[model samples]
Target: MTEGKRAIIQQLLQEYDIQDAQDIQDALKDLLGGTIKEMMESEMDQHLGYEKSERTESEDADRNYRNGYKSKRVNSSYGSMDIDVPQDRHSSFEPKVVKKRQKDISDIDQKIISMYAKGMTTKQISETIDDIYGFEASEGFISDVTDKILPQIEEWQERPLSAVYPIVFIDAIHFSVRDDGVIRKLAAYVVLGINSDGRKEVLSLVIGENESSKYWLSVLNSLKNRGVQDILILCSDGLSGIKEAIQTAFPKTEQQRCIVHMVRNTLKYVANKDMKAFAKDLKTIYTASDEKTALSQLDRVTDKWDGQYPYAMKRWHENWDAISPIFKFSKDVRTAFYTTNAIESLNSTLRRLNRQRSVFPSSQALLKALYLATFEATKKWTSPIRNWGKVRGELSIMYPDRMPD
Candidate 1:
């Protein structure tokens, strides 16, 4: 140590009545303990709007006052310490820095949750905590930390939705989860909706055994129960029975088959050598100004390719009713309903986090991770949809009674 620093330390020791290293350490502990006690008293003062022993003759004096102090042993990086927490007469002063019955004085729990949300495994999270905090934390403790948010996630899932959504996109992403000692692939059905303000929000995340229409109908029922009265457009892939389910549950809703998925499924039937040329020809059909023009171009392509690729042409013609909704609206509104890209983008983010986990221990575990990931992913959706004003104008004209004023 430098001579100046040594002299300063010596001066502090002499002034503070410290005699040795142990004494200095004890003094420092006393200082911290006293500061915490004082802060608690200060918090009570703020809560009651007056310090201890301070009185007023007015009616305010009859309000709450300091009752007593309760002792709590809190674990800190400086080692365990005992501090006295002040209480109010009404037992209502809740201290934020040190809450009642809190055991730890550090932010280790929050750090563990943040790391887990970024797709870190339990072992990795534990190791990270150990490395940074100089203490070992068990995986069970880490699990407990993440499990605390499960109830909140469940509540979020069941919360009421808006009365109407202008457009909603639905899609399913698959994951492996262990159920009853057997690992199985599960489908996470996601719903992204645009509310009256044109802001996008995740409506629901449902875990199912598979992406069957039966589970999807249950999801739609859940939405209906949560007050989703009308949905102008519901976009999805050409999943079987979905259109029927929508007809039964929400007869007014129009099904818009995902044009991107249609294009992808059509390309699967085209030969590798003809994919580029075929895609160019397929574009002419979807991008046409109106249904009549689009169908005319589609017929031209059917004439050119039907002899070689009958199934692709047949699939397009079969789903023409579902695909026709996009053509009725203007280009901006039509483009929004033509694909499920909004929800697909959300799924892409979940997939990135899911890539780190080969299999989840349970459905609850998968849901917890998904909820956290969704929370983090939606932060970027701060602005309204592109060309929202124009689309809203068109939608208002189409659904005059349904649109929000």
Candidate 2:
């Protein structure tokens, strides 16, 4: 039977020059219906040397059927291929869920990583594997394997960036971290970039305890270290001390306060009785057609609330210098800088990942999960951002030294 199979393979080579395992598998798949009878007849009762079973040709077909075989299929990194898994076993042959531990299951890894990113618990992942892929996965092995994505995360974090970013949206996401061996809400400063091609790429991620200027400076410094020479507009919440930090670190950068955040912050001080009236006025201040209209609305909002809530007006005044500039740019620019919405979406994705985690054992573990989540999330960044061409052209004119060659 073995000799005959070899003869068939030799004949196939002579006739078609097909030799690779993937080609063989593809051939086998095509040859399955046509060759099944011939293979059954030739190797009917041949001993396959599998544990605990021996039978003749008819017997093997009836009782000791073949389930599947492992072979290497050359892909980007030679992915493991389950070439023509035969379901010959009648009972008790529950094929292992992960298919013989073939390394670099890119397809499976993507599936598992996506599920893991969406808040699936390890147990849930195991169940999902069983249900979807027909594999039994140990919880610990799954965790260990998923956590292995950190090196990739490190590589991604340290990757080089384009020379110029016209507009950058920066925000911090707080998460529990292992600090001096204790878990706490350490802030992670994240940046989103609108590059010359209009692609919105994530520029950087940093971990810190608080979103202070000193910490943000360190984050910005890391970005500079990675190759970002200049930025035209930087949008963020009113993180005190960040303005001077941006000017000092990214000397040529312009800072814009997130108008959405400013309004929300001011609303906190508005009395409940006047909240509705204040919101109506708030819309006028931020939603106006032009900078002049916006400024006029702001004066009215302040005048109405200032005498009663002096601190609210004072806070708005303090942030006015930062928020006002956004109104001067094009409508597209205004929409983009109105808030830190870019990072906000990323934060939502991270939140979903954490919700599944519940309580993380350590920060490294958290980082591992987040890294995988981000990797999967990036797959959905399939196209460049809107008005990116216009924004990029604007950036080139604004910061000529920063545009990439």
Best by lDDT: 1
Error of 2 at 392 (Å): 4.3
Question: Per-residue lDDT of 1-405 in model 1, one digit per residue for the tens?
Answer: 899989977776776887677677667666677888988888888898887888745576556777888888775655457899998888999987688878777776777777887878788888877765556778998999999998889899899999999999888788889989999988887889999898999999988774556766888999999999999889998776788788877899888889999999999998999999989999998888999999999999999998988887777899999888777788877776688767666788889767899888888888888888889889999988878898898888877788887
- Indicate which candidate wins on TM-score: 1
Which residue pairs show collisions in model 1?
none
Lowest-sum lDDT 10-residue window in model 2: 72-81
TM-score of each: 0.79, 0.68
Local distance difference test, per candidate?
0.84, 0.68
The residue-level lDDT of candidate 1 at 174 comes to 85
Error of 1 at 267 (Å): 1.4
Name the regions of candidate 2 deviating beyond 4 angstroms.
1-111, 130-136, 176-183, 287-294, 389-405
